[model samples]
Target: MAKLKSAVVFLIFLTSVLFQAQEREFWLIDTETQQKKIVKDSVSAVKFLDSLSKNHFIFTELKNVKKVGLRTEIYYDKGQNFNEAFVQLSDSLSSELKIEKQFYTKNLDSLKKEINKKYIDQGFAFSRIQSKYLGKQNGKQKVELTVVKDQKRLIDGFVIKGYEKVPSRFVKNIEKEFRGKKYDEKNLLAINRSLQNHTFVSLERPPQTLFTRDSTNIYLFLQKKKVNSFDGIVGFGNDKSEKFTFNGTLNLNFKNIFNGFESISLFWQRNPDRGQTFDLQTDIPYLFKSNVGVNMNLNIYRQDSTYANVKILPAVYYHLNNRQKIGLRGTFETSTVMDSLYIQGKDYSKKGIGIWYDYTEPTEIELFLYKTRIRAEADLLSTHYSKEEITAGQTRYFLLAERNFYLGGRHYLNIKGESALLNSENELSTNELLRFGGWNSMRGFNEESLFADFYYYGKAEYRYLVSNQAFFDTFLQYGELSSKALGLRPKLYSFGLGFNFFLPIGLMSFQISNGSEFGNEIRFSDTKIHWGILTRF
Candidate 1:
């Protein structure tokens, strides 16, 4: 009797396992489209609902498989109406799938990210996905999804908040660009930055956007920061050649001179042993909505007390895009040496077509992970002599590249390189020499310490933020001078460490540096303190 009972129990357990292994029919129906999807089992039905969650169908529920005779039916519910600003559901569905067309994806996380990103980019700041399954309907599994689109806002127009002296043309120009457009945060930030960079105006506060019904408006509260501006700088240092040196520069700017996006700048500088200098320049932006502009400058300065240098530069440029620009530039320079030097004066003129590209990837507040700029130019140079009746023609090429990187935490880095080549039919003069040194170049060397017919310099700086507004930095500078006629000069190298304090009003730095000349002995020479101030009116 006991053996017979055990055999019957085993047979029943085997039948139950076989029933669980058999496939079941499951259905997922869209509440809006009434589209039906047939799944193989409860697991497959759950996965189908998971895919729907990508298209803002967050809340989904599956019903237990009901066995009616030999068949089982599974059901699900796609919850709510989450899409409001769309003309078709497929549009949002494609975005959720991360594709250009309506397609299916097996990646659950990717679908979720795409759906969330789409909602956030479309101004659905408080949107969420909620799902639930409420029983079966019509012998098919019924599932529902709920998408809560909290705020779907659009851009309407701009309103001037305060009665400030802002030009109507400026306001109109800004409005025409953003009116009736989507509320894109990136574009709005860019516009705000452009307005802040304006020379004659300052925003009392960042422009605020107001939303009403289906539209939004930007409010501009403005004040005249200044119509005229002035800035000055002073420095004192001793060079290896010269005993003591003092330098000072002053700039005076007049904005909106012609009332059509034009400005004039006057600059003056005094260097005790070198000479006094004056510069006048003006620039005008495009008026026809095309990215075309012109700039002109005239500079006259004395160098080394024995020679006076005058330069005039005029250029025209057209922006190709946000990162690229093409320009035509000319340089006319002349030198006069009546103060009794070995040679008289020289004149050089060059005209070139140049292209410039800049790219920046900001990773955090006032920080960037990648930033780079490339400038390359080709020019035809004409050289003239004052005392000697000699004229030379040369073709020159120049390239400059600068890059910066932020490598997490306090680590910041900057790298720069510049090179110039001159192919001449006649001998080149000292006036055409490429030079580097001093504060802007190799910090451990004197001003223009190294000069050559063709020269290249490379610089790298690594900074560690020691405090909220202070940086401890280390730098390495290298330069090479190559002259076919004069033979290759010795390479230059410099390394230094410094502390930089970025104050609220200006930047101050103190550094001690060691440098080598001509790959010879090493010494610490250029230990100095530098301060600079810049304020926007």
Candidate 2:
């Protein structure tokens, strides 16, 4: 009897444990077709039904959920109301998400994604969306979406990772453009373009964004660039006697030496005819953290014992933005004949005021300098001839524009035009006329060889990029020159080919070109050849 009781007790305990360990099975039934499918658990049944709602069955409802023994039954009404679905926004998101308060959509899943994207782009990086079905209403399925916006991020400032010595003011200028704006991809890309091929600094990599509790900060990894440069060019050509002659040019530029984005430049050139030119300019972009800045220029030109001219220009400008500026400039000029016997030139003094504008848009590729650039100035002056003792009113206008167009891969079309006019009712003297022609202007002629009262030239260049640091180009130029004193009105054309490549020392350039008047035959003896190099540090 004792053995029987022990077996019976063991049997009872085993039965109870088996009953407790039984798994619950779920069955989903479609009310219309009466088709049933078995799922492992309640969660699986709900997920399968939700997917059907995303298809044409917009009004899908879990009408009955009943548990019996170890099995559960889920009855869903997959209503065929595929026409429209309505979205109801939560109180917190009503203003932001309610353009057409009740949107019509066939798929609830896509609508949820659309709403999520809207929040993400508006600085809600940590926002979450939860959708709940509220059954069918007015022949459409109604759903409520609640947004949990964890944080809204705005740009606070910038953090420099490398090249820490980069001027603080330069970074401030960049920050001022987008600070306090929403932290999004659009603003991030704008920052990248702003720093691309910058004069003083270049990006080591794309910028990064750091998120904090209070703000979003941009982290810049930069490498300081060698923008200060020394450029020299030497030219060889035949003089009137068919003898070889040499002319040279020197330019020295210092930038950001004081860490203020300021610059100083000195330029001197000697022409084959013994004419010489010198210029000095200084620019301070910002004054005591203000937008106003100053620029000063001094120039002296001597024309081979014929005449000499001196000019001084001082100006102040306001920063319109990072890439453009407008300013007012004052001019003082004096000219004298080198020899009293030189009757073609006269002694004169001029005082003038002018408005100037400058703009630059850097190219997307570092191989090129700029995508577009413009610099223009117009001045009105009162000129007094010391010998004649007569005062005349004069107007001077100058313009330079450059644009580069990309021609598919590794090719570019660069168009450049420059024009200058010195107008007066009185006869203009040789000492006061404009001089142009050189590697910087009309490439085929000697430096400062062409003298004119008014001139305009346009250049079209085709460039093939060999590498990041090398390119080959051929250019055609055509222009007109007018000079009343010389009694000349001539149409001229020039063509040139050049190649620039980078060496260990610097960038080296070489070109050979020739120019002639409309009726003159091109001659090899008239060709001008130039060799130049630019070293930046």
Candidate 3:
């Protein structure tokens, strides 16, 4: 008897182990017909229920979960009244979704999520979505969805750190752009980009957003940068006698010296042909805590033994945004012929009012100057010729565009184009015509060597970055000009190679270039060489 009992107990233990090893099956049942369908596992069971729910058969309960196989019961009915639930949405949003009085969606949960996203974009940061079942009514499931827009959050202000000396006006301008606007990712990114390439400051990192009870605040960590600079360039060229001559340019810029984001610049240049230029400009980006600003410029130009021209320009501008501005400028100019026998030059005075637009986009890389820059101006002036005792109307237009495109790795392409046109019914004198050449314009030629009433030029430079502070570049330029005084309409081309590298004091630049008329052969004698340095303080 004892042996038989022990054997019985061992068999029972084995049976229990086998039963536990067997996988349990899940089933979905139709309550009315008592029909069932097999489900693979718990995950599949949940998916099956979801699929049925989408088809208006919602699982009411899980039955016999711990028995031989799991079972769930579902009832079939028409889904929720989406039209009633959508009544809570704004008219614009409801129209955007195209929800009608008989609106329906197979995936109700997805619809709810999409609706929630729309609210979030509208500054409803803490919005909630809730759904409830009101049981079957008229052979259809009665359901309700509620959108709980807890608090509408707007941008309250900014909290600045890392750089405390930032111009108050600059901060205020940013506030004017974003304060009281929706607190969303799009606005946050715009705020970040506004500070990315600022002339006076740079972001230490991306901007941060903080949320409070009913308002949002942006946190900015900025670093003050040195944008003021002293730049100089010296050129070696041949004079009319084919003798080597030295010419150079100087630029001194002071920016934000008093922490008001103002700028003052002085520039002087002398060409090999005895021509000289002097320019002084001052700019106040903001005055009296307002977005309106003022700029004043004074320029003097002397053409060797020919004529001298002096110009003064005053402008008032409104900031459209961080990267753009539009302004009205008044131009006053006077010119005097040095030699009475010089028939080609003229003594004249000009008064004009014009509209101008400027745009600048800073490069992502600190080593590069700008990603894109554009300046355009249109003016109508009244010109008085002292020698001829005549007055006439003149229209002038100017445009300059520059862009840098990255081609992966360390390669980049810089393209620039500039054009100017002077239109008048009266004759244009050599002194009044535009002059362009040399390192800053049509490299390889003498400074201000080419004169024209209309001109346009394009330049393309390919660069290979050697380091953050060094680069090697080769450039080609092509242009055409019309000069009535010279009776010439000529096309010109120039090519050059240059390199810039950083030194202990500043950046050093060197270039060798040659240019000639399009149909003329290039000669070694036409080559121009330049060396320059730029220091920031």
Best by TM-score: 2
Backbone clash total for model 2 is 0
Clashes of 1: 18
What are the C-alpha RMSDs, in order, of all predicted structures? 13.3, 10.6, 9.1
Task: Give per-candidate clash totals.
Answer: 18, 0, 0
Model 2 TM-score? 0.77
User: lDDT by residue for model 2 over 1-537, one digit each (tens)?
Assistant: 234234433433443355557776767788889999997754565557667755666557656666567766667777776535788775557777656556667776777777787888898877788977888777677887788878888889999988888666577788889899888778889999988877778899999988878878999999877889999999999766777899999999999887778999999999988899999999998887777889999999987778889999999998887788899999999998879799989999999999999999988766567899999999999999998999999999999999999898899999999999999969999889999998988878889889999999999999999988899999999989999999999999999999999998888999989998999999999999999999998
- lDDT digits (tens) for residues 1-537 of candidate 3: 234334433433443455556655555565555677776554565555456545544333333222343222222222343332222344554576566523435466677888888888988888887867666555444555567888888999998999878767788889998999988778888888878888998889998888877668889998888989999999998866787899999999999888778999999999888999999999998878778999999999998778899999999999898889999999999999988899888889999999999999988876677899999999999999986899999999999999999999999999999999999879899889988899888897998888999999999999999989899999999999999878999999999999989998898999999999988999888789999999999
CA lDDT, candidate 2, residue 504 = 86
Put down candidate 1 lDDT per residue, 97-147, tens digits, no spaces. 455542223343454456666676787745675434444443333333345
Runs off by more than 4 Å, candidate 2: 1-115, 129-147, 165-168
TM for candidate 1 is 0.62
Q: Which candidate should be chosen as best, given lDDT against the real structure? A: 2
lDDT of 1 at 364: 36
TM-score of every model?
0.62, 0.77, 0.74
